[model samples]
Target chain A: MKKTLAAIALASAMMAFGLPAQAAEPIDPIEPVEVKNPALVELGKMLFFEPRLSRSGFISCNSCHNLATGGVDNLVTSIGDRWAQGPINSPTVLNSFGQIAQFWDGRAKTLAEQAAGPIANPLEMASTHEMAVKVISSIPGYGEYFKKAFGDSKVDIQRITDAMAEFERTLVTPNARFDKWLKGDKDALTAQELKGYNLFKSSGCTICHNGAQVGGQSFQKMGLVRPYQTTNTAEGVKAVSGRDQDRMSFKTPMLRNVELTYPYFHDGAVWTLEEAVAIMGDVQLGRRYMKEELADISAFLKTLTGDQPKIEYPVLPPSGPETPKFNPWAPAAK
Target chain B: MKKTLAAIALASAMMAFGLPAQAAEPIDPIEPVEVKNPALVELGKMLFFEPRLSRSGFISCNSCHNLATGGVDNLVTSIGDRWAQGPINSPTVLNSFGQIAQFWDGRAKTLAEQAAGPIANPLEMASTHEMAVKVISSIPGYGEYFKKAFGDSKVDIQRITDAMAEFERTLVTPNARFDKWLKGDKDALTAQELKGYNLFKSSGCTICHNGAQVGGQSFQKMGLVRPYQTTNTAEGVKAVSGRDQDRMSFKTPMLRNVELTYPYFHDGAVWTLEEAVAIMGDVQLGRRYMKEELADISAFLKTLTGDQPKIEYPVLPPSGPETPKFNPWAPAAK
Candidate 1:
């Protein structure tokens, strides 16, 4: 029994710490997200860009996770309803489906649940689920599309979130230059990038940032070796789990498009890759990165940029008479 | 001498009030806006969609004059910075280049001049030209695009507005069903729509509304036959011309995509096309439209819906370290 328990612990550790050190592959290239329903995807695309979902009739999911700028809005944190500051950085929605769970704390297990987070957040879309359903129902063109996407004649929040997830599933960015290198194309990576990859492997970044998404596979402490001081009060899993053991631990974010997803990390305090790498070396891995190492690593990051999806703007339906008037700035009347 | 004077006065009146009694070709179809420079148009597209030009870095020309929704936000008036109400309804940007002059009051003589209006207006973008220029110059990606568009290394408001105008020049939507009819497609209009067209022509609606854009060729009194009731405080061209005669006189709006550009007229008080057509009959001409006549006119207007421009949303450059943090929600420092 003692020998069997020992074998089980070792197996679990190997899976948790990634494949054995000398294993052939360390990280895998991200694959494109599968879209089974094109009609559902189309409806989701319109809903994703529909600003009328917000109480302000202006903010949308695209406002934060903007696909035009590498599926991230490229802000330290997102500005939301009534100009409210977001609690944390907006992650790239490009390969979000590959994440073990959604959100920094892994609170939501699926993209559908994650999407519903912003729609009703007072600081975000500032709209209730009920209002969102009502508003969409009022728009004449949206009703038929919803019915076509889902068999439901009456639109609901569950259908709205599911369609949004279905559309986002198709937003995966494939064929980055680094991905080409990962598939055994020797000429794909520059000398600096290869050197950076070597340093990254030896210095232990791949321990957390591995697999298809290059990091979103598991949860780990943000500052294991040293405390990371930031004004951002997000305690990560502690807020969700209500346990001291889970404090300061967050779901590792994907780094496929790290070049464009700047202002790195959960706190979003660092602006450049060089600075972020240096801080990560000190706080997470307990290694001091030299200036040359930072430069090489940043060069490697740039190669991750893929072809941004060229989306033709959807011609939104004209507002119906029953639609609520845009009045975010007006004083609430008694 | 008396006969000659009488002939001269009659000719002047005919020219001012459109072709007299037996006017041929009363209301021509709108022509497409000409594009001279590809590079300038590309840069202008980025600038037109650049929300960073606004004080809040959230609203762009596309916010109000949305390409995704028939060039109009479809609101009674625009909601500006901090939710301030706009003084008038936003005009359609599509086919607007065909207007005799820009704005309802003919305040800006050219599209380039008109482009500069909203950037500085407190109720609009709420950003001064100096700040706009400074912000654009600060972004490294925008600086290079400007240089590529215009051979100037140093960016300024004039060059910015000029490039934007060049881009707006390409926004014309041609080939409406009405335009096809104009080009001698005899079967273009349905029986009801054709009757509405005949009524529109024979009922003196074309007296001021004659031209390529259907109405943008001249200024006309809002209520020539009866006093028009609207709570909107816009004094029309009188505010610009400082002439009592110009009071309640506005440059007639184009009707190319009237179906999508709803809540008709300058005040934008009316919602349904039927009611708007009825109001025009009572106020513009000394006649009242029957319910069926209003329905027919509304149906005919829907035929004016043109092929909308398919625009790929531009991938905006990431903000530099020097870029201002989005903090409209934060309290001003004491």
Candidate 2:
């Protein structure tokens, strides 16, 4: 009976240390996207880069969520309509659909829903759904695109967001070095990086940071073990739920392409990956990692960098005479 | 002697009426671009779309001179740094290389020279050449590009502008209906359009508006036959040449994609092509064109809309720790 107890104790200890768990892990590799409708995607690409959708006719979906720089504008926070500074860091749109819900507060349930919020936001694009539709519909060239994409020439807010969401779903980045390692490539990661991965798992970082996107699978409190200090006024999930307990709870930001999307965290208070990791360890895990351990973990995080989307900048159709002129300061079109 | 004099008068009348002059006309079709160095062009394209060159890190060259919409921002005058209004209209970059010089005032003799002006202009990009170079050099990914393009990894203002110029040279748009007609396609222009073309030549509009680019060949007075009224303070070539005679003298604007580039003239006062044509006739040619004549001439101008360049939006590299942060309010970097 003592031997049986000892055997159980050894098994539990091994699991805690992440020993012999390398073969089956919590993290999964990102899968390549399979596009079903090419025409819809093509139309969506045009709309994604169409700045005419903005009130100033200068901003677009790509303005904040730039595909060129790891699906982010790489700003600490975004600059919006007439250069109004955004409240929080613009999150990377890469593999964003893998998240259970959209936005840091999980307010948006789908990519399409998320796409609708920014277009009419006074601080962002500052254009209404009706105005956006009117501008697109008024253009003679977009008629053929609408017809080809939605089986009609009619332009609507629903079809617009649907197309954008479909295009965004195709923006998944697969086959990072970490993904290659997960897929059984023995030499994909360096010895130091592999050690860092094991440490990351054993230290319980993967509790909320797992799955294909690494961190977007769950919402977690910002400061679990210790209190966090920040000047940013955001109340996280409490802003949406109106619950005191949900005050500091936020959707875990995905780690994919985190290397390119810098000035880390919701407030974008942290600039370096090392500092971010150190803060995470102290406030979330109650761990004081050694210098080398922090470096190793940061190295592991860097391995999440993946291929970016190759998008041909679509030449948008010229505006027709009926298309409303861009009015940066005007109220939303009724 | 009487018969010989009558024959000369008939020849002069036929030339003035644009009869028997179809075979050898003033206009020439735009030639296709010949790209000699693909690497240089690729590097140039990346730089062209790079907003990091701006002090705000939000406005690239493509922001004002947008390739998606006839190479111009389509604004009356460009909205620049911190929403500063520009002095003059932004011209389309399409087929601009065919011009004798760059800018309305012809201040810059070459596209390479013109490329350097906006980067440090306080109201425009508001970034110094040194700062722009530093930002590009700090990015590790741009090193390979510089090396491939210039046979060295050294980033400088000259090489940067040169690469941009190389890319700009390839922005030529060919294969318009007018170009097809010039190349001997009989059905390229309809009956009304053909009649308009003849009237356009016979009315002496082709005196200044000629060549492959239609109008970029000469610096002509804005109101040659009458005093033009405008609230715009731009003195045109007088601002550059500082001569009283050069006042209101500007480069004859290109008409290649005139259909897409609306809000005509240096002040961008005229929104309709028909109104612009009527104004041009009254002010520049000293002739009052009838309503149907203006409509016909506008129809002829619409045929000049060529194929826009199909540019794949370049994926820019991530900024490094050493790269300078964007400061919209800051003075130029030393």
Candidate 3:
């Protein structure tokens, strides 16, 4: 009995460290990815918090990707221009730097492209590129900052996109329990969670969900192994790329903070992480997880959450003589 | 010339009193509408600012309708539910009580309906009605308050909606330069603005834009006289209501803070208020205005802005055992 207990403890410890209880391939340590431009990231942080970039003169990027939360407003879809329903689910920006593409349809190839899309998207920033330039240029401090940041006082789309992308890149989730376990923490997971992790790998989830980003490196057919009904599939890449086969294929999302970023799935169909895990297993993995397995998997997935990145508000530039308190309806002095 | 000036002064003074400046009949003032329960409004205010209502355990209504900037985020659309675009513009909650209906599509018939929409919206609060009740009820202070407000500790949807609606009703835009002039402040508007106001009425803008809310009481074809092409028109309305007549017909929109609400129109096609006014005259009113007239009208519209409403955050209730800081992905204890 003493020898059996010792063996069980050894197996448990090994499993907690992301090692197989029996002999198997050892997992590698996750390398910390460094952000390229700290200054641009700092600048982007300020810009993200600045409401002046919006037409309403009140909303900032933080309004949606609220830092205090899991970097998402927990709504089915966001409200925007004229209080209409946005076409897609808002993805968390926490581990977005790991994403190969941005947006549900993956219309943007780079973070810079993604950054510019929202600033000029009528439903998002509601400001035209010309208006954004004009608004930024009107602020003397911003003009100077632009010159210092991008070698020009002339505010343009490229600098704005670069700055925002730089800021977003810094929004990485910190070391999660899973990462700690991978780094050899022997108490990071439990026996049941270890079983769930094994199931996750054997179930073929690792086929698409392997990488530092976990799942953002590629696109896959959501219902490849099984059939699932989705309205978005009908309106797929045709609406964006005007192509076929791109049909039913979406950018695989990063699962870094998946526990907090719900309702899950592209259309926000699954509200609970357990339901999502179960559905993905059934529909994508071609198997149905048992109740115990589902619960354990959910517990394991929860270990993926990490500390949120801290962001500071930007100091607004002095309003030009033409601007009045930045009030949209303030009557121009006759 | 003296007699002509006297007549002009008399006409301007009449206009100040919310009366028509020209031959149009004077319209009645929209009566002050009363909320169903004033105490509920007080409660709603508390709930609105409390981050505990959110799934991630942070973010309140004030997170978007920031009181510091005219009760709007100033973004064309707010980010929510994982940083996705909110479908419509975040209309300033200021003076929203005067709106005939809530939301750009007139989806919510009352403030209560509007209040409930966001809380349940997957992208906004990402909470269900039951979840909201459970969370609120878990708070001891909220239980007592709900009992006091609704005669029950078991808070229901109606009570929550009523409280929020009551709070929203109090968010009226106070006196602005326009209001002061209406109260007989002779110098409230300049000569150019007065001319612009005259043009505003004479050009028949008063036909659709006349009301306490300035324009919320009606919905008219975007281009009544001349057809204006908008890429988002057909699909936009279709997304909200499947009705065909609803095509190109959006909420007339309140022009109270027109100057602050930028990238004008439903699709945010017009970048500036001046351009919007110009387009309205050409397409809706079927008349053309000179650059000078557009400038003056734009100036007159500015006077409609009022002081920002004061908002106080509520003290959190301490009843429920503080759920360990909502770490959705934290590993379970061994």
Give the residue spans of candidate 2 off by over 4 A: A1-23, A327-334, B1-23, B327-334
**What DockQ, on C-alphas, does every prediction get?**
0.41, 0.52, 0.04
- Residue A111 C-alpha lDDT in model 2: 90
Question: How much lDDT does each candidate structure score?
Answer: 0.80, 0.85, 0.65
True contacts kept of each: 0.52, 0.58, 0.03
lDDT of 1 by residue, A1-334 (tens): 2332353455447657865422444677767766688778888888888888887777889878877677876667887876678898888888888789999999999999999999998878888898999898888888778778876567889888998898888777678888887765768889888677767766789899898788999999999999888888899999899999999899998888888787789988888889999998899999888798899777887777776666778778777778887666655334
DockQ-sorted candidate list, best first: 2, 1, 3
TM-score leaderboard ranking: 2, 1, 3
lDDT of 3: 0.65
Candidate 1: which stretches are off by over 4 Å?
A1-25, A151-154, A330-334, B1-25, B31-34, B151-154, B330-334
Find the 10 residues in a row with the least total lDDT in model 3 chain A. Answer: A21-30
Per-residue lDDT of model 3, residues B1-334, tens digit only: 2332454576768767877432342222233446676557668877776665655444467666655455665555665544445666677677787777887777788988887887777667556687777777766667777776787777877788778778888876656676666555758878877666666766677677776667878767777788887655334344468887776776777877666555567665555667889999899987777788798788878777665454543433432432323322224235
Looking at candidate 1 chain A, the ten consecutive residues that score lowest on lDDT are: A1-10
DockQ of 2: 0.52
In candidate 1, chain A reaches a TM of 0.91
True lDDT of residue B213, candidate 1: 72
